[model samples]
Target: MFVSVGVRFEANVEALNMVETAGNYSKHRRVPYIIEEKNVLKIIYVPAVSGESLAHAFQELLAEEAISEKQKVCRKCLRGEFLKSMDEENAAEKFDGGKLPSDAEKLEEGIVKNCTVEDIGGFLYAGKPPVKRTSAFQVSYALPIKKIAIYSTVEPQLHARHAVMTEAGKKTGGEREGAAEQMIYYVETGTAIYGFTFNLDLRAIGLSAITGKPIIPEDELRARRRAAVKSLARMLSSTQFGAKLSRFLPLGGIVSLAVSVTEKPFTLTSPIYEGFEDMTLKRLEKIAKEFNEQYQYYVLGRNGLETPEHVMTQLIQYLKERNTL
Candidate 1:
């Protein structure tokens, strides 16, 4: 049962950076590319966002949630436990290789025989191995419908240190506080629609082979999918990424989850909204009708538009019915 989601978000000074340092001109934030489509020599800057940013934001939120709630993460391997076991294994090896047949040798033998010790000094220590699990959640680059403008401004800040000219001044280098300036860039207000999808196919990932665990139980997979959906709903609401970017909150957006009733794997994405007004039940209905005859949708926001309350209610009901919640 795979599901596709379409997202439309309103930006009030929302900025997705191309590089880390937005203040530096060399590393100023950019969508992706600036190009021209023409027979004549011309150039155009295309404003776009990266899917990596979206994935990172969600992943950071998940890590924080796991830490705060004391919940175990299912998507990644337990690095802490693995590290501790490796440390013990290393200590045992050191002791076993010593001159005397000591108690550490017996301990080493026990550890070597332990079921948890899968591949010692093999793929674990050598090169970077590929990801084990396929991420069911995905996000596309957010490209604005209309042309966007970028504004650059320099702000002053106080610095705690300063440079001296002479060697004598350098020797007496004390706190010479001074004010510094830096330039910041921001994208002009515009709406960008980001496409999303969630593939529920488990067998394709080969989870059992990667994690050395049995096939993920139905209940667990359902729980993971539910969490992923909840995280998507909270993408704008949660400000773990930054309060400034998603500051104004999502004015309105449409998220549809089309679950296949049959055993076959299927996915369906809603049409990308060119503008906020485009997010409507009619658009969602078209996607649902085209993708799967049997499916459910959750429409959010009542910003001067006709929005049914039962959409959310029905979403919850369907989740409960599917034993996902």
Candidate 2:
């Protein structure tokens, strides 16, 4: 049996969690195992035992701390440039000569306003002129599976779940169903972390250098990973911000209607100021709202309204029919 699949990096986190659980896995033999940064694979020439053993092996793999730790950093390293930038500023001589970060690093100048938690939002992203996304913001979204396709033994629809199962079986084959099984489980919750890096000094220098201020050094590096993490959990699995965004940001265009908006900037526009907040996540509560509306409007037409699900169904079918979606 050869089951092949490609999962998002975030999904891999849960895989580790699942494999760590002893009862989630069962290893019957020494099957070949291959684990890649973004891919996992397994092939067995045995009977039903192969399937069961693979499942357990995956669980054990998920339980490992190294796997989880790597997953945590995946979000931070999406842009190798950004990570390098942060590291550079961390060692710059500008630290002793520059000023210290007041609240943030990228948006160090962003005054710690008197605004309440209700007033906090992620950074805004405005595209270059002519596009007119005045209120559009940015979000560093690691879309784990942007285009998932499988060309192997089973149906395409079965690839996702079977991928993890196949990887697990190779780790544990004949082990009894107890601690061994718990080790076979992986994080199957489909949750990914969404948050912006709080960079102040480095961003300032990259776009508009903020000269070293007196006693307050500017070269020192700091990040708002903690703040972003705190804000991220407020959403439902990092995709649904629920109703919390309505207060800080209105729901109208794409910018206002997002469900889980991040502060990842897409570009610098005319109205954009060369400052820190330029890339900081200003409002993240409303994500993809505008995209959904536009999709529905274009697909279903303004004369009639269709539920997102219905519109999406039609869109998928059309894509499959034309092989474009």
Candidate 3:
């Protein structure tokens, strides 16, 4: 069975900008938008998120959660706790007179042969001139649910120490700088929504180079998809999202699925709103209904009017009903 899944989530944040561009204020200062001419008479600048950012976020989440069940797997690299490998590489380089072995040499000498984790799979196979895997997932750029507030603030930064230098036989130092101020622009309040779609085709993604397998089993794909979707929901509260400036707390999210017996894939480009959470079900149903008229698909969403768990439950139920649990 093939499935086309679309997901969207709401995030409540003090400041969150999915897309940032350099501003005229300073090279370091960045804002979420840029001015563009709508026509010969008018120009507009609006807050918008790029699809690239959402794609990257989802990719990171998926990579983090999707564990390759291969013989050679590095657990440390999978968790992003790869300090030991880095230290080992550095030590090896130091031992090799500050020059690491080339790719040919490393392959011939079998150095770090066991580092074939999913995270570094590309690098491991780089020697063969890698082939890219077209991602089955696609996400749209996020936009404000309604209105967005863009403002700037000036904050003071203090230097802890002054630069000191010893030239010749005398000690010299630059004048001590007390503090500096920086102008920062932020999105005060707005819930951004993005449209995302996943096209799951085992033939396109299931090939195993290690075993020379042509397809991945359906059970394994279901498990991976479940983990990935759960991780996607949890990614909003991730501490590494935007650090201090943006605190994107998880509000809620909805994911609807369209399972087909055939291989035809459909894309979901519908818009989602934050405050109008009830409409999520209605919208998904409408889309599913429209798509079902042309092709066979099973549609499911939350049958309630609540927040937080509504979307999560909808996803879980959808998966369960489809026997993908």
Q: Which candidate is the best by lDDT?
A: 3
After superposing candidate 2, which stretches have Cα over 4 Å from the reference? 1-138, 141-209, 212-225, 236-238, 241-325
lDDT for each residue of candidate 3 in 207-264, tens digit (9 for 90 to 100): 3433334333566545555654555445533523322243334354443333232234
Candidate achieving higher TM-score, 1 or 3: 1
lDDT of each: 0.38, 0.22, 0.39
My TM-score estimates for the predictions, one after another, are 0.51, 0.17, 0.49
- lDDT per residue for candidate 2 within 20-103, as digits (tens), equals 223433221222222233475543221011222322222222122212322222222222111211322321222335333332
TM-score of 3: 0.49
The predictions' CA RMSDs to the true structure, in order, are: 10.0, 21.9, 9.5
C-alpha RMSD between model 1 and the true structure = 10.0
lDDT of 1 at 30: 40
Pairwise lDDT winner, candidates 1 and 2: 1
Off by over 4 Å in 1: 18-28, 31-43, 64-71, 74-132, 146-214, 239-293, 301-314
- Can you give the lDDT of residue 56 in candidate 3? 52
